[model samples]
Target: MANNQRIQLKGRVFITFNIKAVTGLHIGGTESGIEIGGVDKTVIRDPLTNRPYIPGSSLKGKMRSLLEKYKGLRQNQRIGQGYIHSCDNPEEYPNCEVCQVFGVPGERDFATPTRLVVRDVMMTDKSAQDLEVSGRTDLPYTEVKTEVSIDRVTSAANPRQMERVPAGTEFGPAELVYSLYDGDGCDVQKDIEHLRTLVEGLQLLEDDYLGGLGSRGSGKVKLENITVALRVGETYAEEKKLLDKFENLGCLVEKLKELQDQIRQHVGK
Candidate 1:
């Protein structure tokens, strides 16, 4: 497929899930210097309410990176070096799974549009009230964590403070939207494959960390109360309301697997 090729929208799948911090999460914000008597590192917050929230970019970027790594699509570069670019020619690399769902950069020739849409995750009001009642008196909805790095040569310690969203905080409702395109000719199964890949990506994200400082135990999160809905045609009446409800993370994974299997069977036929 080429960028000039025509593509038609078949349907869209909407996935909604909640993210709960299993451990303290530190998605770093702009650095406030010690000169201002502010913390060395701060967590991003809502300006109006001053409540810490996870940016959609953070979650989407993390999921894309993890999925790329899982599919061995990562570039041959050292950590903190550079990012891998997606395939430029979809016709040449027709089976490039990551590029299909996540969309290729600078690839106007790619037939399919970007399939995934991730929304910014906000802290639930219930969770915020719980934090206050739990006696977290440091800040309104965040905690300051003190960290230090020791220089082995001189045995000197450099200390800094970081702001983080404390453990057990719940953020929702996070939404992930996946677009399904009508495949060309015998490749009609492409939409199913893409959805399966997206599901797998989310599963991988659940097993991994979301924000910065993962090696030091920050950014561990769990997805909860996942619900799926589908819109099959152009009109609102064509919608399939709440197709499935997943009670827990494990149940969601299982449902995805079942859906994948069914698609595989259909393709085989």
Candidate 2:
């Protein structure tokens, strides 16, 4: 249980896919100065393209949150307004699925390399172009919806504008780079199994939602057209495709047991 053994880098797994909005999606953008009733909400956009994109941080954080909630892990780490679970105990950290996959603070003695890295997902070219030319959409690459918050006591109606990506719009070529580390041991079975954790998070997201205002019917999404590949440490330069063009993450989840055997064959050889 000593923290002296060097952590060995086994390899890395790359998962690429498409995320389609099942419902209107709203991931808020920053507004420096806002006058009353002037677009109360806006979607985050790429500075260069001015196109809305799903940030890696948002995607990764949501995945972690969902996994933690599913596992019913104790909420200890306070992030912004909400709390998240993080194992402070080195002995217990290895057993916590959330910690093992998402990782704890690097400063912690028990901290290992975080297994997952979710990349920012951009709006598909076709979706962007279609939204622009449709002329039916309220905004460029997005739509605006007005909702009123009625006061119970005074019955005052406070209406606010919300910007969202229209349902059926696709944002993808999204990628999740998961690391495989053999900590203090040559065996990387645990690292490989962490793949399940990633898939589980994706599946949970499908059942749940992404971005904000999920309860009020925004952020429902689905993953599709997945491609997974592996890069072992020995043959790092030559990456091998494991599951080429799986229909969805659910398919990957279904065959994870067999997939592990495939990974073992590639990495072990």
Candidate 3:
């Protein structure tokens, strides 16, 4: 008979941060396809506000891809498969860290719930106002970056226009929530380990790029003012109290380490 068990909610950790463009950022949007006159690539934007924004999907996808590559988990079978690769074969590999946090596809019989939730990043009010004052005059809040590709044989330069959110643009504060579970056989250590991995993934992302055209001096970004809050147990009161415990990125990491040490002590008992 198959084992039947359900995971129970324990608590949650909420992390908030800011993303500032260090170079032109270009997360692509739908092509206008006005063949006569249109940029080759366009940045994604908010329809109502008409301001460029970063999608949570784009951030999460990029982080997962970077972490997978760092962990050497990017085998041929998993490369474009979209997080569905199996980790059920314990003999081959036990406790796949990536899947446990990011989640495996529904088809995986042993799949657990995804622990991470990334929120869409919107432009700060000040950034929007700055754009308005600067007066782009032509493209509004975005910059039209032009590039030329040389033909190898004829050495002819072909120019194309690319739309991007320019450097110094700020969009955030981005939010990420990590869920902790409670159950009879819950492994708290695993949850802590997952948190560490997730934070490390963000650090790796900071060292890398956010959107597209990274190779051509676009998409460099910096994450700042990271703050984290944690709530324990299953009550609104506890959550309310936890709101006062927000800490900066450094303090938060230290607290997590302290928590891990305490858990280790209890487990050792």
The TM-scores of all predictions, comma-separated, are 0.87, 0.94, 0.85
Candidate 1, superposed: residue stretches over 4 Å from native: 1-4, 32-35, 74-81, 183-188, 237-240, 260-269
The CA lDDT of each predicted structure is 0.75, 0.85, 0.73
| lDDT by residue (tens digit), candidate 3, 137-180 | 34878899989999999999999999988789899899998877
Q: Write the per-residue lDDT of candidate 1 for residues 1-269, one digit (tens) a residue.
A: 45345566656678888899998988877764546756787888888878889898898888878888887874643446677646655463467777777766543545457778889899999998998798864777888888899999999999888778999999999998876666442143676667877877778877889888888888889999888877654543654656678977789767776665543443342
- Residue pairs with backbone atoms closer than 3 Å in model 3 (clashes): none
**Higher-scoring candidate on lDDT, 1 or 2:** 2
Instruction: Count clashing residue pairs per candidate.
Output: 1, 0, 0
Q: After TM-score superposition, what is the CA distance of residue 29 in candidate 3 from its true location, in Å?
A: 0.3
Arrange candidates by lDDT, descending.
2, 1, 3
RMSD of each: 3.3, 1.9, 3.7
The full ranking of all candidates by TM-score, starting with the best, is: 2, 1, 3
Summing lDDT over every window of 10 consecutive residues in candidate 2, give the lowest-scoring window: 180-189
* Model 2 misplaced regions, further than 4 Å: 1-4, 185-187
